[model samples]
Target: MHRQIAGKLTGPVTKWIVLVGAIVLVGIMAPLNGKLIDVQNNEASSWLPQSAESTKVVEQLTGTVDPNDIPTLLVYHRDSGLTTADLAAMDEDAKEIEQIKGVTAQGAFSPNEAKALIASGAKVPPLLSDDDKVAFVAFTFNFGKNGWQDIPDAADKVRELSKIDGVDVHLAGFGGQASDASEAFEGIDTNLIFITLLVVIVILLFTYRSPVLWVLPIISAGFSYMISGGVVYLLAKYADLTVNGQSQSILGILVIGAGTDYALLLIARYREELRRHEDRHEAMAFALHRAAPAILASAATVVIGMLCLVFADLNSTAGLGPVLAVGVGVTFLIMVT
Candidate 1:
C-alpha cells in the first residue's frame, strides 16, 4: 500500500503536479500566518477555568468594576526632602495623566487632593511618605479587552509627563507589570522564528556536512511553519481555539523540530536506496515507501500526546495541546509531500 502510494506520488506527471499544488497552497496560507498574533487571548482570566472562584468573581464584578481596569502607581522618590516645587509638578503630572485617553479620572488623587483629604479626615492613605522623601499617584486605566497592548505607551506617556528635577519616577502595580510584559512579548514571534531557523540551520549543516544539502530540510520546515500558523490562526479566529504567546512560540519550534526529523529519516532512506537503484526517481519512491510507516507512526504519537492536553483543566494547557498537535501534524504532511 505504501509502495503504491509512493509510486503514484513520485511518478513523472504526478511529481510536478504535487510540487505546483504545494506551492499554491503555501501562497494562500502566507497571509493567514501573518495574522495569527491578532487573535491571541493573553488576559489572566483566559488561563483560568470558567468554574474557578477567581473566574467567577471576575464575572460577577464585570459590570460593577471595569474588567479592563488596570490599577497603576506612579512612584517618585528623592534622596532629599521633596520641595514645594516637586509637589506642584506631581500635581500637574496627575492632571495630565487623567487627560490620557484610557486613564480614568475617578479616584485618581493628585498630591494636593490627597493632602486635602488627609486634612479633612476622610481616611485616605497619605500619598507622601513619613520622611517626606517619597510619594505616589494612584489611578486606574481601561484600554478595553486588549489593554495590555496599550499599557507600554500609556506608561511612557506618564513618564514623559511626570518628569521632575532631582526626582526619580517609577511605574508600579499591575499596569506597570503589564507594560513590561507587553514589551517583552512585542517581538517574540520574530525573534523565536529567527533563532529557531538559525539553530536548525547550524545543526543541519553540522549533521549533513554538506552546505547545500541542509537547505531542503530548512525550506520544508519553513513551509510547515507557515501552514501550521495559518491553520492555527483560523482555529483561534473561528473555532474559539486559545493561542497565547507561549503556544504561538512553541508552535514554531515544534514544526521546525518535527519537520527536520522527518526530513532526515527520508533522506537517510533515500541515500541508502540510491546506492541500490540506478534511477533517482525509483530510489526516491523506494525511500518514501520504506520511510512512510516510521514517519507516520512518529507523527501520530506526537499528535495523540498533544491532543491529550485537551483534558487539562487550565485553558492555557488545554489550548497548548491542540496548537502543538496542529503544528506537528502540518509538519508531517509537508515533509512527507
Candidate 2:
C-alpha cells in the first residue's frame, strides 16, 4: 500500500501537480503568514487560566474597576537632593502627562499635589523621599483591551515629558512592566525565523556534506513554517485561538526542526536505494515506501503529545498545544509530499 501510494505521488504528471500545487498554496498563504504577529495577545491576563484567582478577581472587578486601567508610577531620583528647578520641572511634566490621551486625570498625584495634601493634613503616601532625593508621580492609563500594545508608546511619551535635568527618571509599576515586555517581544518572530533558518542551514550543510543539497530541506521547512503560520493566523483571527509571541516562536522552531529531521530520514533512505536501483524515480518510490511508516509514526506521536497540552489550566499552555501540533503536522505533510 505504501509503495503504491509513493509510486503514484512520484509519478511524472502527479509529481509535477503536487509540486506546483504546494507552491501555489504557499503563495496564497504568504499574506496570512505575515499577519500571524498581528493576532498575538501578549497581555498578562491572556496567559492566566480562567479559573485562576487573579483572573477571577479581574472578572469580578470588571464592573466596579476599569479593567483597562493600568497604574503607572514615574520615579525620579537625584544623588544630590532634588533642587527647586527639579521640583518645578516635575510640576510641568505632570501637566503634560495629563494631556496624554489615555492618562486618567482623576486620582493622579504629582509632587505639587502631594505638598497640598500634606498641608491639608490628609494622610497620603509621600511623593518625595524623606531625604528629598527621590520623588514619584502616579497616574492611571485606560486604553481598553489592546492597551498593552499601546503601553510602550505611552511610556516613552511619559519618559520624554518627565525628564528632569539632574534627576534620574524611571518607569515603575504594571504599565512600565508591560511596556518593557512588549518591547522585548517586538520583532521576535522575524528574529527567531532568521536565526532558526541560519542554524538549520549550517547544520544541514554539515550533515549532508553537500553545498547545494541542504537547500531542499530548508525550502521544505520554510514551506511548512509558512503554511503552519497561515493556518494559525486564521485560527486566531476567526476561531479565536490564542496566539502569543511564545507560541508563535515555538511554532517556527518546531516546524523547522521537525521538518529537517524528517527530511534527513527520507533523504538517507533515498541515498541507500539509489545504489541498488538505476532509475532515480523508482529509487525514490522505494525509499518513500520504506520511510513513510516511520515518519508517520513519529509525527503522530509528536502531534498526539502536543494535543495533550490542551488540558493545561493556563490559557497560553492550552493554546500552545494545538499551535505546535499544527506545525508538526504541517511539516509532516510537506515533507512526505
Q: In candidate 2, what residue range of length 10 has the lowest lDDT sum?
A: 104-113
CA-only RMSD, every prediction:
2.2, 2.5
lDDT of 2 by residue, 108-185 (tens): 688878899989999888798889998988889888766757788988999887877768999998888888988988
For model 2 the local lDDT of residue 288 reads 92
| Residue-level lDDT tens digits of model 1 in 1-337 | 2888998888888988988988888898889998887788888877998678998898899889888889999998999888888888888888888988888758467667898988998988888998989898999988886686778898899888888889999999888898899998988878988898899899899889998999999988998888889999999999999989889998988898899999999999999999999988888999999998999999999999999999988989899999999999989888887
Model 1 root-mean-square deviation: 2.2
In order, candidate lDDTs are 0.89, 0.89
What's model 2's overall lDDT?
0.89
